[model samples]
Target chain A: MKKLILSTAALALVAGFASADVVRMGTEGAYAPWNFVNDAGEIDGFERELGDELCKRANLTCEWVKNDWDSIIPNLVSGNYDTIIAGMSVTAERDEVIDFTQAYTPPDPSAFAALDAGLDVEGGVIAAQAATIQAAFIAEKGWTLIEFATPEETVAAVRNGEADAVLADKSFLDTVVGSDGLVLLERTEMIGGGVGMGVRESDQELRATFDAAIQSMKDDGTLNTLIAKWEVSSQW
Target chain B: MFSYCTDPEALEGLAWLSCYLTTGKHMGLYISVVTVLVLLAITAPVALAFGFAGATAARSKFLPLRWLGKGYTSIVRGVPDIAFFMFFVIALDQGFEWLRHQVKCPDWPDAIRQGNDFVVCTAAKLPLSASPQWLHETYAFFLAVLTFAIVFGAFAANVLFGAMRAVPRPQLETAEAYGMTRRQTFWRILVPQMWVYALPGLSNLWMVLIKATPLLFLLGVEDIVYWARELGGTKNARFTDYPHGDWRMWYFFALLVFYLSFTKVSEVVLERIMKRLTHGQATSGGEAQRRANA
Candidate 1:
């Protein structure tokens, strides 16, 4: 009986370790530069490349899962995936729900893009992605904020005249404003801390593995190279 | 579309417009229309089969079967369908994972529902964690179809149940007088006659099913509505070869025309079907046709 129980316990341990080998990386796959789905319908962006490198360095097999921005964190916490590398910035409110690794990219300034110049930033309708730091910042500023599910819809709201302007990460708006008929507002505000990988609070061991990988990248300047290559904000 | 279209920026007028319409993302939009059609084709028959089962159960001599059928039909009638659509997809997904977790990981100790989070064991993950992108999409599409069928199947059941009752009591009595068994009467006499009565309600249900295809976007299937919003929105020069202003209104207009034409064709086809089903029947439609022929 003792031998049978011992063998069964050992088998269970092996099975547990086997299941832990593959880490699922959740991403919005809609945010450009940070992450977005390519024309061929695969997750392709800066984060995609960075996440792959982090998985390699950590010696963990990683797979990507595209989730909507609104449910990304909840899905991460709910065990839909193992980690969130979806350009999510570290915030106190979010930290309360889920834990984060070291910041992968430095804090990027948020800018407002509008069709017309000089719209009232205080009272006019401003669009932002729902549950984002920019959306919370706009709400704190007492602006009439219209929240959208994705970043593209926020820009669409500005162009469709539903909102006067849209506030999002500057790198995101830069591509939008460079196009015709839309211009970035002079007013830009930096909100939230640097972006980080989110892991469930229960998964501290997985978080430590990624944090070490991120720290090594930061130490060796490889992180900064990726930041520059992706045309994101300043280096760490 | 034109020979000079090689120079996108240099080309002016219709040439530029023609080339712009043929962008890769625009091809996705075209494919989405087929997605909607495929969904309708699959769901309609599945829902009809479900409705047939539910209606048959409702008319069964057994008490428990009748209550089960009644419960299925009436429960869905009480709530808005969009609410049902949103609720069932998540509920069913979690439900499946939970069932798998119980069987696959008997030794795992954590509670599956931790506060608002649903934490199933890694081994129990639906579609498995290592499944390809296409499998993930196919899984979501499968969930969307199941949700659509269940909700619409209840509505179809209600219509079919009422149609069964409308199949003239005397026709069933005639079957009984001819020494037919109850099951034989149901199959031979009642089933054929119910369709004539059910045709109008089913056609209306078919129209509702078409309009509800847009709800697939809510399930994250990237249907035509999603593609339209993505491609028709302002495309900056940095992101695309063909930059354009906000042309969402035009794209939506195109969707509007497509649905209208689809419904028009469906209406004509359904009318012809109704005529065929009503032929030689005791309905007003059959009587009018007979009078016209005389």
Candidate 2:
């Protein structure tokens, strides 16, 4: 039985497949302006545009993979995709597991949006998307934090009264605050260095390829143009 | 893809919608419906087998076996299915990787668990890092099926155990009186008659199992609920090709219709099976069937 089990596992291991040459770019399609699926049901947004350009510059064939935000990092680590071009922040904690290319977008302000202007954010229930920089910041402050699976849910939490306020990147909240009767809190916390592509630590070569592509985009002012067009964050 | 789908931005009306529904991501949503059904098909029988073993063990003459069976049913059934799903998937995944770590990287120097991370050698990664995307999806799906089987198996065992006992004591006595052994009596008389009693409980479990298929998203499988949420979300024109307002309500309504139709079909099939099982049995259903036939 032991031999049989081992042999079956070995057989499964040996059946390694797929085109190693095609770099799969994983993104959370729910996050708008950063990365989202358009009406044509195609991945669109700053990251999609930026990722395509980067892949082009790097001379790599790339495909998009839409993944839920909660498992994005783990999926990238598990080799479900070659890179996470999602609006992932560059943080020391995440750097322990995955290597990141240099920042493509400047450090975006993390703002709190509440139903009312003067809501006490410190004491009240705050919402943040799970596994995000804002969520970590909220947890570290020992504030009551309600974490949701998607960015939209965090905003919805504030609207539906499940949370007193939702803390997220200003780029994301800017679209929600004015339209949904959500008022941006005066308080803004700049948490991450910047948003960048995440690659597995072992893929230093792939990391280098993207890093170079990003650097070229930055140098030519094209990165800033895309960031300005999308209004994702502060331009370089 | 329709011919007009070639220029999605220009198209409007049903033609646009026809193209929109046929997009690659939408196809993923459609395929995920199959994923849910496939999960149901595989999990039901596996759960039944597990339940049979557990119920048999619960009634075992050996004290230890009875304790093991009872413990399996009670402990698993006591925990919420969601909690079990979240905990068990991670644990089982780590368990597999740990086993591989032991065999493949026995000489590794670093601790496996560091702070919040579960680090194993790259060689020990389940499905291996270089493996295909389908392999990753299949592995996650496999883990989900196992998790569902284990959790639902406990519920099934509870139902089957009650059903087994509900089989009349005199039926087993009759078998023993006819020179049959305890084992023979169980298989020949008790087992056959328990189905009529078990069907109602099992059918309820079947519905619960169907509802529980959406929890596959929590296990990282891109099942129907995930796609519904992803697709039905509002899209901005600045970011997407086919930007639209929130259509989650409509998408979820479609899911509601699908699940209702699915359960309706299941109810019809289960009713037929129950009728078949009740035929000539010493029960109210059996008696009714005989009377109707006469």
Candidate 3:
């Protein structure tokens, strides 16, 4: 019985090694245009479509998992999911933690959205998503930065008067400013490197697969088409 | 919603308001209230059962059992409830995955915990990475429930232990005099009598549990608070049919009313239960009732 149990366990271990084909893609499904959860409770939006296309092109079976933005990178390293297809900007600070594919979308200006234009952008309380380039920029400028876990919360902070303004991607604020008693400030500055898919540093082969897939899309103009369709950022 | 709600921006006043409330995201917010209620409904009885076992174990003649129950009740008391909720969920999740890893992959070589990363083999992944969306959600919800039950169970056990002791010794003596066995005496006398003493603490715990439901956001469960934040955020004209300003305060106010009414309803029910349990008992409430009747 002991020998049979040992052999059975060995077989199971072998079976476990054989089923490693599927790549789990994690995204903060709360971010719209980039990625968001639809009314049907499925992951929808730009990255969802792009991720599926990339997966098909790369010939890798992929599944999407929704995770909170704050812990997304940590969870990736911890093996919760294999790749982060969230709207994560390639940054030197983030590069220390995980590897990134080539830019899927080029760097876009991060704009300030406020109730009115005149609020002192430098001195006034500003909200940004935690761990984003905007938050780092705000901190460097010596402004009071109230960081939130998700991008939406940063905008919510501005709307609720918790902050004077919010600094986020222009593409995201473009959808928010006109109707929500908010107006985008004129002095938008480009921040961070282009957005890319993040993978664990150990997963070089997986990173190469996605890197090639992104390159193919870029070459065929499909990447630019999706960017325009989603109105994500300024096209590459 | 009116038929004219098809053109939301064109509609104004009460018509627009009605249409706004019936939006799909608003419906998600409404359903989240059911989620909180379901969590409470499932957790309360499970916590109570855990509490009963803990209290029984604490009172046992066996030293190890007594220590275990004592440790369970006291250890959680020192940590803040939120801290316990946050810590226990991750710990329990990792614990389950590690056990599964050991069983499923005997020959797999790497240490499961390498620095900060929990490197489990793919097959050991809880809910197994290949499971459906519902299974993933169900697994997360199940973990949340267990974490809640474990934390609240300790508090419930503390209340029950005191309640068990508060049961008069003479009542047990009377049962013994009637030729009852120890188990029979405990069931017929002690357990029945302990309820009246336990009611106040248990009701307070229920209220705490209700308030703590908001922490489900931390657990990554989209509870009412999450929905309130999501749906109440500024939705510009480009994003939604019923574009709104920061209406989070209003959504939160609605949640406030929901919780207040829920607590009010709970208070009335608990009062009736207390009255029922106190009836014809040796307590002051029972004595007052007897005097009033006489």
Candidate 4:
């Protein structure tokens, strides 16, 4: 029995580093501010900066990979990438497939940045993709509306004056509205978002290392400086 | 699942209810099927109209008009359909606005093309800058329809042009020999008989049109394929009232069944239409019809 326990512990030690210091992280380069690709072809978003800091603190070398927006979760579960640092929210459906680190960023009030006219999310029926917090908020408002396949379409709707405003991520709210002459009209109580790290179920040790790195960044003001540089936090 | 379903106390029952309501995405699933149907209903007629015009133009005596028709038909078959689907809608949208820009904002100094971006005057926006919600969706749906029609119309024109050519040379000669004008021969002898040849090709186009409807999702139209993937997945506990596991695969399976059944039903209906169109004509199909009936 003692031998079996030691073997199990050894196996656990091996499993912990499944995605060790040389971490392969995935981000949606299309989502601006959070993790969008700039004209220079480098991933230069808030999450990318934060991801770098976390890796630095963890003493891990990192390789960044660009992927399609929707495939992030599937790739994570299948071990295609070590972790997803995209501006993804923690939701019930995602919990089943993979584990997420505690939210590093709190969700800010979601609003649509309309290119055409000023938008008031309070009066308009909430329109967000289903299963998201935005969708839940719209449901809470007791309004019915359409859901789009991507943030790009949602933004296009506002630009075309198709939707009043898109219920969307905060970092995107700034980039889209700033670039397109859109304005955010409201704010909601912030919700916690899964904007930290992701690891496979077997990589509990890897997850712990990420959690420790995040904590260290917060302790050393690396997180704050990065946040200030990227302008990711609205309230910062 | 049923016994446990009402038990807020029992996780198993709650799981069932969660699955039931969240799987309500099935409603979205069915809506996409209608999207495919709507795409077909609109595209078929628009394509037929485009094809008929193209075929007519190709056979025209005038130089530019015939070239225009032949050009339209040839363009469709050469490039990939996806390329056309992507290019035409944007190109046509810009084409409309560019015309409008010249007319509406002619005094504006800025060039519309600045490197990579397209910037037109606010007044020149398609559907205008001040249109309502329904107008936008309708506008998108209409653009999608136009794209589908323009692409499929070329294929239809190919079928139609061949049908026109298949009419016997003697038939046209007889009309001319009997002192009929070219116009008279075309109308009296050629046009009506062409349908007997065209039905087989037209029927095939209809089946292809059905197959192409799923592409609506790619065009940003929230058709059935969009809804199926959205609604068919399993919900987890982080979500209350609709907690289930990943079920997207099963939902897509149902969609496959729906599409298969729809295609089977169409084949039977199209076969019947072919017989009706070919009946009592002088072509082989028509002769075969008469002999079989006799």
True contacts kept of each: 0.25, 0.22, 0.22, 0.00
How do the residues A176-197 of candidate 2 rate in per-residue lDDT, one tens digit apiece? 6665577899989978999989
Clashes of 4: 8
- Write one digit per residue (lDDT tens) for candidate 1, span B1-294: 446667688877888888777756567788888889988987888888879888888888899999999999889877797787666777877887788799899999888766555777778777566555455566677778778888889899999999999998999999999999998999999999999999999999999999989888667677988777766666555545676777888999999999999999999999999999988888898899899889
TM-score of chain B in each prediction: 0.94, 0.98, 0.94, 0.84
Please tell me which predicted candidate would have the highest lDDT against the true structure: 2
Interface RMSD of 1: 8.4
lDDT by residue for model 3 (B144-165), tens: 7777888889999999999999
Candidate 2 is scored at a TM of 0.82
Give the Cα lDDT of each candidate: 0.82, 0.84, 0.83, 0.66
Clashes of 3: 0
Candidate achieving higher lDDT, 3 or 4: 3
DockQ, cand. 1: 0.22
User: Which scores better on DockQ, 1 or 3?
Assistant: 3
Q: What is the alpha-carbon lDDT of model 3 when measured against the actual structure?
A: 0.83
Which candidate wins on TM-score?
3
Clash tally, candidates in order:
0, 4, 0, 8
lDDT of 1: 0.82
Off by over 4 Å in 1: A1-20, A115-119, A178-181, B1-27
Candidate 3 per-residue lDDT, tens place, A117-222, comes to 8777877899999988999998888889899987878887887799999999988888787765789998887789999999987778889999999999999999
